[model samples]
Target chain A: MDFTIILQAGIASGTVLLFATLGELFSERAGVLNLGVEGMMLIGAMTAFSTTIATGNPWIGVLAAMLFAGLISQIHAFIVITLQADQVVSGLSLTFLGTGISLVLGEGLSKAGTVSLLPNFSIPLLTLIPIIGKIFFTDQSILVYIGYLLVPLSWYYINHTRPGLHLRAIGEYPSAADALGISVFRQRYFYVFVGGMLAGLAGATISLAVSPGWFSELTTGGQGWIAIGLVIFAQWDPIRAAVGAYAFGALRRLILDIQGPVLLLGFANPFYYNPYLGFFLQMLPYLFTVVVLVIGSREAMRKRIGAPAALGNPYVRGERGK
Target chain B: MKKFLQSEWMSRLIDALLPVFATLAALIIGAVMLLFLGVNPIVAYKALWDGAFGSGNAFAETLVKATPLLLVGLGICISFRGDVINIGGEGQMIIGGILATWIGLTFTGLPGWLAITLALLAGFLGGAIWGGIPGYLKAYFNVNEILSTVMMNAIAVQIMNFMMRGPMLDPIQAAKASKIPQTARLIEAFRLARWSPTRLHLGVLIAVILAILVYILLWRTTLGYRIRAVGMNPLASRYAGIKVPRYIVMSLLLSGAFAGLAGAIQVYGVNYRMITDGSASGFTGNAGFNGIVAALFGQLHPLWSIPASILFGALLVGANQMQRVVQVPSALITALNGLVVVFVVSSEFLRRRRQRQRLAHAKMDDAPPDKTSQPAEASA
Candidate 1:
């Protein structure tokens, strides 16, 4: 495998998680755990795929995807905030609904034929660098560059800004935030919806940029949940989450990049002849996730700092000790 | 009307009816979606019901669909009662099926009943181990089972693909170079006895019996009480001398066992060969996830899930009939089922609020007689 090429692809794929992790981070900060990341991404991917196909414009595709995803997220916000439904159940239902609808629509859109993939452009001097620039700064989609801006922007927004503090307060103790005149409901709704939109854009990153077409339940191949996992792995910090996402992305691509050579050279020996070795390698991403989750959370589970104390609780006005 | 509304039986009746109402609302929403696609709602629904329950053949097919669902849904009820969500049912079911397939193929020397029983037990163990992982994780380390279980589903899928394409691949098919992923057909002695003409097998009876057993286990047994208590309040259970974590793990084991049995039954009874149908769904045919939908729609009761699974099963079988006649894709069932789940999840919250309201009303109704008479006396 070409190390630079692997890094380039891994960083590009990692940007998908960057958008979703940042979105989930913001939502969790505002005390809403939106488990519908997979669903929203599928909806975004489907919409973006068809829209880009119709207009032949990837930018329009991304925007439409974000808008549709944001709209769908409202269903979640209303169920969680207004109806006071269980966040997990509501989020799961959102996923089921999103995946089902996306597949149904994707059948028609995929029949519309593939659209032009998102264009990629490289920086002049950065592109000239031997390996480092090739992996990080050059030869990535515009979305990856946007994701670059987002990592620092989200960190600054959460730590240095006024609303960010309120967001933290709401997540930690909604009653206290309410006492301080923060509309916990409004803030949660805003963040969850924004998170959904980001998930949508991330979906478009798959369809319009990453894999470059719509596939059934394609976003669910562990990306959304990985983002959700990264949220916890990062302890809800955007920068740490980015690190986790990139590492996972690299790991996800590593096996694929090396499998061809390994198979041809019989490097894996007796197992090399096994046709199913590919499936075992496919298990790496998920197995690694379980390992990371167990180890990362071995000691301080909930007491881990940066965990939004009221993360999954629905904020009710004047409710004591909720 | 006022008297009927005020009657004590009314509340009980409403509790029973809410799920029905939710199911209807879900179907109606599905109908509207159909309308948008230029199909008449009346025609589509009529076709659905006819295909599901219209004849003996359809009912038999519906039974096939409902069997796994009932088993899996009941499993869901068991785990949820202990406050553990076992979303790993898909993986559990697949592993169970694979193990059962192996057992049936390897243990052919045994008698029929013994062979089936051994295979089923192996299946149960496979699922129990799979489900227990998340249970143990949640109990000891507080690893979120939801994340773990969902991730496990993907892993399970790969494992299934590997087994089918590699070690478990039918030797005959391998020699022929067939790409179809499946095991060799089970030995005839191990095949489940079918009620002729109707494809119904003994698995339906097992599913029904298990449903009752789960209901009894949940409500009549001490284990059930402990599980429910832990689910209701872990702190209170701890105070009352219950080991919350133990029950949590046990709940998941029993849950996974039930789901594993479902998969084993599917292999031994319905499909007779373990294979993927090549859809976007996993080998479990969405049964693991859909069982959650059924359990939710049934209000998480084992008994209620029977009918809930039937309704969902009918939708699946009937959707095929509907597709034949009305040309609406059967895939729409997933979306329709998703809508039902959305409604059902929210409706349960509404049901709880109404129960609270009813209790408050009863308190007002039983208020001091003197206070009640005072209002009349003051009016006079």
Candidate 2:
């Protein structure tokens, strides 16, 4: 019911999704639909959690997470890009692998006791503004602040930069890009590695800031998948993805925030009130994801809006496909 | 060029050997990982092998684990071959189990065969419906099956949780103290009969028969041809006057039914009661994901999934035993399974590359003599 409270919390929590969506945005734009965002996120989360615990520095944890995840994503890049395996299968298996590896490595970190999560702070100049400042800029985690800067930076990078154009060109028509002397394979590998590192950072945000600490397959609760969905829902646009992520974050927060009142309000009939009514709240975000995906897909297909032309297919020079 | 990877027979040979080589390579990688983790790889593997296949009892457990995997993998084969990824097997399995549990609990005094048949049918139908939702969306609305299926999984889990805790709470447990999420034991007549020593039940037979059935349905039937044709080239299939969407729906439905059967049989044959620990893994044992791994290892063939599932089953059983003896967490096995999947998929990639190379070589060789055949071969 408190709009500001929900908005603040949504921005704080949605940073995880924003990072993931941005990461996926890069990979998809490069024409390699890396579905292993979830996997990379998990690896990042585990590395960040454990590293932060060991080194007592959240920044160190973030760096390791990105490094480990980016390094691991080479396996995916090898299979999908260089080897030309099915991207979806490779991505799913990467997730399965990532989840397994992270959990195996992270099992002891959580039980090793409480670890320091990245704390929130407000900018002095920005916090001094009116109601706008309080709603938009106050007391946010460093990740959320980074996400805010990331939005415009990504937008500019994707739409304005020379390298961004080349990335887009390769994704849309690798053969044409190859004809133009662009190394489609190298560019794809570059983006996949970069995207994977971002995904790792997203996972670090979850462990170090969002949820704090680590749990077995903790990110498996569909956030990574939702982040992938956010890419589509954003029509592969950066700013749009940011809005979508925050909106989704708000929706995710609704599950925890609404258990008491929203259900009671939605089901006005007294007979519908059950003690376990709150259990259905857990299903909200997933259901929302499906609904959003359907609509996003409908829009994308209807208008042929914003997807890269050769999104899921791997490129093999001089090889014909059925 | 030394006849390297040439000829269709040679390609087939590689296809057959690829999985074995991949499995070995993955095991080697796993061994390296174990060594890095400060464990003795040989001793650990010995424990794993002994645990999975050492004795008659262990072998029986492997069969038991393989049963559900084989069924689900076969189901996934249908969907994957049709180019529709039905990742919602976990949801399908959960819904199917609940349906079977309901049938077992609701119906009484019926003959055992009739009861079991009805229960199985209910489970299959439940899973089919659960799967059909994504299928229908993909067919009519162009929705992504993978994401839709994932969403369906979440909804399915919530539904199971609500039902189990609310109305379906084992009446006996309702009467007593209960923290564990479960239903009361099913009626005695509905329980699957087990063999004396192995304790493996009728589900193994069902799995074998269904595998054959899937193989036949995929290769022998016209529906199968249409599905394959659609999967190969939807635009071409559409041009050829095939209804592409229908095949997509059919594949997903069939896949869901098989997954549902896996769930139903697990309740009847192994667990004997419908229970969940409020996590997808606890109820489905990650069988949904494992099934995908099996299907991939099997080269998407139902017949091959039998051995693939068995191999996966052995790994799981072995890993559990290894965990107990070596003090390694069972999570390591999951990571190991992921490793196997990656290796198998990568091997598939290499195989395809080699096939492409062979085709290119063959084209060049025939270039001078086969001017007339060039166009025909290009299309073929």
Candidate 3:
């Protein structure tokens, strides 16, 4: 396997996951666990594909995708925040709603196959640089740079700003935050909206930047779940989340590059003749997620891991103290 | 007697009307979407109804679809009433099918009745094992059951995929033929005999019997009392000397067993072989999740769950017809299911609000009498 091709795929996948995980980080920090990221991403991918095909402007399509996903996720926020619905159920329902809606809307568009791919941006000096610059900065869509930029920007907004502190406080203890006159509802609404928009952008990256095509049921294949797991692996830190995404992305690419293996020491190795070993390897992320969750549940591991304190709990105004 | 009749009638009316109301509201929402799609909502719904229940065959299809749902829904009811969210029904069902297939393949010489019984037992044990893991974790480690169960589902899917593609693959098919990964079909006698022109089997009767048994297990037994008590308030139950953790584990095990039985019935009655990628649609097209919706709509009661499963089954059958007749997506059914769940959950809050309003009005009416009494007491 060529190092450069592997590097390219890694960067591309990492860009998609980074955007999704960063968005999820914001939502969780605001005390909302959005399990519907996959749904949002799927909606985003479909919208991006359709809009880009219709308008022939990848940028406009990306914008449309973000707005579409954000608007849909608003329903989730409305139920969880306003109606005090269970967050997990609301999130699961959001996925069903999003997937159902996208399939209905995207069916015709997918059949048409009119999606136009986004053009790559190349910087002269950066393109000439060695492996590091080639993988990170050159020969990628503008959105890749945008995704990279979002990491630190998200970190700043979540750690240094007043709104950030309030968001953290709401996640840690919504009652205390409400008592301090920070509107938990407004903060949650804002973060959820922002999270939805980012998720939309992440979906757009898949359709517009990475593949730039419309394929039915191809938009989501559990990358959203991986992004959620990345948020946990990063301990809710945005920058580290980006790193985790890149690592997962690299592992995925490495597995794809491995070929021609038929060594069997036992009676018969299942992997020796199986052509679908590649597909099984693709499932590594989910396996990793389960392993991390099991580890995270341990008392010693939990102390080291960071999760939003009030995550999945509804916050009502008058019921703050109680 | 008149007052008692009125109260009883009103209670029954509310109980019956709530699910219908929720279902109607969900349909209205779906209809609005259909209108947006430029399809006539009335025509679509009529198509759906005709598809699900128009003829003997269609009705049979609905019943067959509802069989697994009935089993899973009953399980959901039992677990949910005991305050355990057993989302792993799909996984348990898969494990059940796997175990049944294994037994059916290995013990070919056994008599039909004994073989079938053994298969069913294997299914129950398989599901119990799958579900009991999360139960043990939740009971002992304080692990969140929702996350743990969801994770187990993914693991079960992988395990099922591995078995179907690897060890359990049928030997008759050619290597390059792209055969469906399934085991050999069960012997004829071991299979469910067709009772009518339709494909409804004796398994439906088995489902009904299990439902009644679940009802008895949840409402009649001392163990049932302990489960309910723990569900109401674990701390209170603990103070009352109930082993809350044991009940949690036991309830989950029972839930899994019912789910496993559903899978076993599916294999022996319908599919007759374990298909590869059997769970691609996730829990055989989300029968388990829909079972949750059914259980909730049925108010977490086994007796009510039978009708609820039938209704959901009709919806499934109808959605397929609606897709063919009106050219609308079948996913509208899923959307409708979600809407039903949302509305049903919301009704509880609405009832609470109404109760609070009535209490406030009663207090307001008694305010002047209380004020006058307070003045008299002060003078005295």
Candidate 4:
């Protein structure tokens, strides 16, 4: 397997996880843990594919996917924020609801053949940087370019901006933030909406750019859950999240490629010899997620820094404690 | 009117009727979906109702379907009550099936009753081990149970796929060109007794008996009390001298055990062997996920889960008939199940608010008559 090609494809696929992991980070930072990312991504994938087929514009498909997924996310917001329901249950049900709605709406889209895909082109001067240029700036999907920009922007926004401070304050100490005139409920809802939109964008990136199609539940393939796990590993930091997402993307691509070759790095490849061993290869990403979570948890314990304090708890205006 | 609304009977009535209301709301939405699909809602629903209950045989099929759901629901009750969300039921069931199948295949010379018991026990042990890993992770390592369980489910699915296509492949099928993934037919002596003219098997009786046993466990026994106590308030339970982590682990272990039992029953009573279409849902029929809905619909009470499982079982079994008659995708049922869960959980807000109001009212009654009463706005 060629290293350059694998890394290139890996970056394109990594953009999907980047968007999803960042979305989940925003939601978790705002103290609303949405376990519905998988469902939302599926909805986004279905909408993007079907809308592009109808509108003949991949951009419109992306926009529609974001809008639809964002709208559905409001259900979780209303249940958890307005009604004070359990976040975990509401998130789980939201996933179910999202999956069901997408399945129903996406019924025939999988077999609808091809539509216009997102534009892909390389940057002029950036391509001259040798290995990094070939992997990062070479004819990549526009979404990949957008992902490159999102990482640092999100990091700066969360760390330096005034509103970013407010976001952190609400998540860490919502009751205190409420007393200081920040509308915790509204901000939580908005952040959850932002999270949903990003998830939709991730789904759109998949259907329109990376691996375009609506293949039912397999379209997202539990990447959403992996994103959630990534958020923990990143400790809610966007830059760290990008690194984890891209590495995971590369690993996922590697697993598929490893099974294809008859020989490995000048040795016999067992995966090629016994195709059944590929099943174990398929388990790596998920197993890696578990390992990542354990490491994140242990680090948090050591550092005494972890998830937002009020992450899974609903904010009541007159609550006694967080 | 206020007094009547505040009565104990009124609370019970609302508790009983809320799930019905949620189910109805979901069905109404599902009907609208059918309309969108270009099928007549009335015609579609008629097909669904008739398919679930039109004949004795159809009803038997519904019960047959409910068996696994009930078994899984029992586990849901145990885990959710212990405040552990065991989404790994899908994985636990597969591992359980694998173990039970192994037992059935190896110990063929034993008598029917003893062999079946040993196989079921093996199934429970396999599930417990599978489930206990996540439980142990959550309890000791501080990992999120939901994410871990989900990961475990994925791992279990791969393991199932590997087992069926690898070692567990029926020797005869392995020789064939098609190589369909399945184990050999379970020796007939080990199979659960089935009534003629219907697919109903003795597993249903076992499930019903387990439901009663679970109810007794949750209410009558100290172990049940400890599990519920941990769920209700782990900190308080710890302060009260309970081994919080141990119970957390036990709850998941027991929860997984029941799901494993369900998987064993499915093999010994329903399918007569382990098989797969290369996906967890293919073999488990999504019963692992559906059981969560049943548990919620039953108000998280073990005994109430019986009817809840049956109701969902009807929806699943009848969806096939609905699909045939109306040409609407059976996926509509999955969507409806999601809607029902959403509604059921959202309705909980109303119950909680009313409960708080009742407590406030009780406090008000104890106050002196001369003090004017103020409305408790905690409902907000």
Give the best candidate by DockQ.
4
Candidate 2 stretches greater than 4 Å from native: A128-131, A260-275, A319-322, B1-11, B360-380
lDDT for each residue of candidate 4 in B182-271, tens digit (9 for 90 to 100) = 999898899999997799999999999999999999999999999999999999999999999999899999998999988999999999
lDDT of each: 0.85, 0.86, 0.79, 0.91
Off by over 4 Å in 3: A2-4, A122-131, A211-218, A259-273, A276-280, A299-306, A320-322, B1-16, B81-84, B136-144, B222-252, B277-279, B361-368, B372-380
Relative to the true interface, what fraction of contacts does candidate 1 keep? Answer: 0.64
Q: Write the per-residue lDDT of candidate 4 for residues A1-322, one digit (tens) a residue.
A: 6887888889999999999999999999999999999999999999999999999999999999999999989999999999989998889888888888898889888899999999999999999898899999999999999999999999999899988999999899999999999999999999999999999999999999999988888899889989999999999999999999999998888888888787888888888847478788899999999999999999988999999999999999987999
Q: What is candidate 3's CA lDDT for residue B198? A: 83
Residues B1-380 of candidate 3 have per-residue lDDT tens digits of: 64553354664576567778888988999999999999999999999999889998998988888888888888787777778878788888888888988999889999989999999999989888888888887787655566566666666777777777677777764264876666767778788777677889878889989889888988899988888888879999999999999999988888888888888888898888877653545436677667777777887888888888889999999999999999998877877887787677666555555556557666766776553345444667
Clashing pairs in 1: none
C-alpha DockQ of every model:
0.64, 0.75, 0.32, 0.79
Off by over 4 Å in 4: B371-380
lDDT by residue (tens digit), candidate 2, B286-307:
8988998899889899999999
**Judged by DockQ cut-offs, is candidate 3 incorrect, acceptable, medium or high?**
acceptable
- What is the DockQ of the complex in model 1? 0.64
Evaluate fnat for each of the predicted models and list the values in order: 0.64, 0.73, 0.17, 0.65
**Candidate 4 C-alpha error for residue B93, in Å:** 0.7
User: Worst 10-residue stretch by lDDT in candidate 2 chain B?
Assistant: B369-378
Higher-TM-score candidate of 1 and 2: 1
Residue B271 shift from truth in candidate 4, angstroms: 1.0
Per-model TM-score on C-alpha atoms? 0.95, 0.94, 0.88, 0.97
Candidate 3 root-mean-square deviation in Å: 4.5
